[model samples]
Target: MEWLNKDVTIYDLINDHYRLSLWGLRCINIEKTWGLCDEKKLSEVIVGLIDSGVEAEHEDLNGNVIEGYNFIHNSRDTCDEFGHGTNVAGVIAAKKNNGVGIAGVADGVKIVPLKVVNKNGKAHIMDVVRAIYWAIENNVHIINLSMGVEVISSDEMNLVRLAHINALKVAISKAIENSIIIISSAGNNGEDSIDFPASLNSVIAVGSVGVHKVNDTFILEKSEFNNSGKKDIIYAPGEDIYTTFINNTYSHTKGTSIAAGFVTGIVAYMKLIDPKLNQEKAKELIFKSAHIISNHKEEIPFINADNIMISMWREKVNK
Candidate 1:
């Protein structure tokens, strides 16, 4: 999908190329899923999107964006140059009622854009660590990381441990004082083990799932670039998923990135419902409510957002 310029319109693409109908089945199902949760009301929470950058002024992401920072260049405007971050951000909280483009998973939530990568779609380990520290310092309720590095360093691992401890402490304190949640993307390398941060016991590791045509079964699969393991990874819709606002245009990108955004949106909604919910409880809610899809029962596990949200609502009402 080539863009006319940096300010292309969704209507222009639709009228010229017919890109919207490419994934007709998936688009229809996504619309249905949005319709199911629209009545739940998710406007009261804040979520942080940690990635390359975001198009904060995009029509579908205007008022929903709160504040943003770029750790790559240490700037305040975390604008998208690689377009990956904008797509991930749109998945979490693209504004609704715009009557132009597609809606996000959590339309009402506020997005705190944290840019940690550069235009080449690369980020340094120190930059990511600083971004995490910044997110924690800023009291971000939920942080979504869509990027991953293959090699892990001691310093990086130390930072990961520090983030995990900080997350746990903050979550516990929040449960006792305020209530917060943290979510991270399960890496995109399709391996037998999980990566850092996501592999950390504190962060929620998210995996990818594809709707396979054979036998009508939804397969909890890993992306070719995802590192796999028996870590605390949960699966979400990740294969060939449609995201929003790329290079000032709309496009579909596949990775654990979108899946992590999906989970971030849900966690934001959950926080909105129960402000006192801690990280552990939130994780428990996600795991206990997730739909099981594995046959062996010993391999990695996956999650169904629709089911998990329903279960959370039921639990809330029961309580």
Candidate 2:
């Protein structure tokens, strides 16, 4: 194929923080997967970022952001008042090789900035459900949810809470039925339980892994604040991640929220390479290609972007 011998290096990797700020990207081996396809095709992959909102004018995110609705105020303005959405968007699609800020995992993919949360970092369950249905209607390729409702004790589960959960589940089911990949952060609570939406069976759950240098070599360790569960969860770099911030600036943040963005960015590329890819196949490839952080099978595996991309590439060509 044309991409096999394509000059990948032509795509700039020299953004100001490429070396220093993008420790998470390096950990996932994201650079090796660049230039694997036509940049224009990659641009067609859209990720619906359901969060507070995005600063559309942010230097690193301006052109890469697509129009989306603000469910909070029922307006067109998606400016991120809380700044969390901008952080996650930066982790997923910050401009590459701008020689300005840090680069994202999939620089070519466009982000659909859906505002489901408010400035106080609070989101209504119905708002999130509406955003998912909106994304399904818009036919986005992926949905990256960096926010979720915390899991409460079983004794506290009430009919109202269950009804809300079911509402989100139904919306998520419709998205998946339309072949939209939904990924959510496991949680930042550091508990053994995953958060809602992510805890849903069909959604891909992502946890945070901290990158540390041990004896001059980097290692992936589970972040203390990353929530864990027994099933269908993966890990990615989260600690000290430097990405785009509001006000056309940048900052370092950490959480499973950032981790979910990393997976979403990688999955965007996978969808680009294999348009036929769906939730089941994407999750299979992700879990199968993941690197085991420890010897235990139950330990959440960290994402290996290079491995999964190559696997997807081979599958595309083999067919």
TM-score of each: 0.76, 0.92
lDDT by residue (tens digit), candidate 1, 1-319: 1110123233332322323432322321233234445434565566767787888888778878877788877789788888888888777877644566665667778788888778898876666667666766776777787765453555766766556545644543442233446666777767676665576676687877655443554444445566676666776667776656655578877777787877887777667666777878878878886655544233444554555566667887898
The backbone clash count of each candidate, in order, is: 11, 0
lDDT by residue for model 2 over 1-319, one digit each (tens)? 1212234332346555454657677678666688565666778899999998999889888888989999988999999999999999999988877777888888879999999889999999989989999999898999999988887765788988788887888999989999999999999988888998788878899989886555665556788887777767888889999988889889989999999999999998899888878999999999999977762223557898889988888877897
lDDT, model 2, position 241: 93
> CA lDDT, every prediction?
0.65, 0.85
lDDT of 2: 0.85
Best by lDDT: 2
Minimal lDDT window, size 10, model 2: 1-10
